[model samples]
Target: MRARSTVLAACAAAVALLPAGCGGGEKADDAGASASPGAASAAPGPIPAIKPADVKPLVGRWVGTAKDYFQFTADGSGVWVRGGQRLWSGTAIPEGGGKYRFSWQGGDLKTASYWGVSLTEKNTKLLFAGTNQTYTKAVAHKGKGKG
Candidate 1:
């Protein structure tokens, strides 16, 4: 009898807590419920693609604010450095349109998408669509030649 009573109590408690455990309130509209004003709730818009030949210009050091930068090589590998420390080393493979798939090295093997390289005589910019970050090409510093 005691065992049966304990079982009944447990079942009652579970039933009482079920509603709270789930999102058991009034249903909210799909659009307005979760999204804040002026915020994007859906995926971002498509980025413009560039030809494969255009990717050649991307092979160089690009710098961002706070010492964050990326160094890409002709072989398609690159490294992401932030605050003078190497954070992620990966391969930026051109995906045939302006997009490049940045595949990080390691067990996790995370990947990011980058596109939109705008180049001018004085400046070059690479846009990372995921975070909406833009990195400018870093000009090589010239040293004084031996006199």
Candidate 2:
């Protein structure tokens, strides 16, 4: 029962994190990125397919303003961190149309959620359709363990 409650709470947090696009987009600044112009519009269509190579630019540790982050790996696997603690293991599945689904596993969320990406002057920006929050690629990281 405790596990279920935790999962439910986590699921609620995910929903809260993404209230706009429900997931994520890409940028075209000659940098590694993924997102569509209408990706966060009122209505969405089929997401574009992504290649492993294309996602390479997005692979790395992304830090959020409040210390939340995403550590994406080249093998399509990733870890989502919040408040310095590991939240869940995630899979970055590329859905067609410049959209990447950030699905959670081995934790609270089991459903697949998508997100888009955009390149910045210094780092990369990761955005989900629902929430306005963005995860920027970190310049320096101390590794994950619960800060």
Candidate 3:
């Protein structure tokens, strides 16, 4: 209870620092009218099925905030890095229809973790369990006019 109170107080303090109710209220409708308070939110769209080709595009280096790195190889092998150190290495198996079952030996989730496909963003997939966060693909830059 004490920890909860402290966290709530911190959140309240943080919210107070922001302007006017922490950016809530007065959501606009599709017809350019204000939505009612406590109105039902829009439903999320369906997750698309992933293909082997989709997984192929993700076979590269990906970098996220705080030195988080994700790498996938063509030969069903991959690596995860944090703070310039190897965090996890495992094999990725395709379960058909754009989903992958990640299997790691000694890591966060030992058994397996389900991954879904994002058609809009080809490089990254949604982590369904443990934590919900998007892992972004790392972009490589080349010198101008130098192959």
For all predicted structures, in order, the TM-scores are 0.48, 0.48, 0.47
lDDT by residue (1-147, candidate 2, tens digit) is 775565446545664554333223221122322222233322333334445676676688877655467787776567666765554454566544444665421111222343433434443577644344566777864888888
lDDT of 1 by residue, 9-93 (tens): 5434423432222221122223323321122243222223434454677789987644467787776556766656554454555
Our tally of clashes for model 3 stands at 2
Candidate 1 error regions (>4 Å): 1-55, 106-123, 144-147
TM-score of 2: 0.48
Backbone clash pairs for candidate 3 read: 50-97, 50-98
Tens-digit lDDT string for candidate 3 (3-56): 556544543443233223212211212343222112223221222333446468
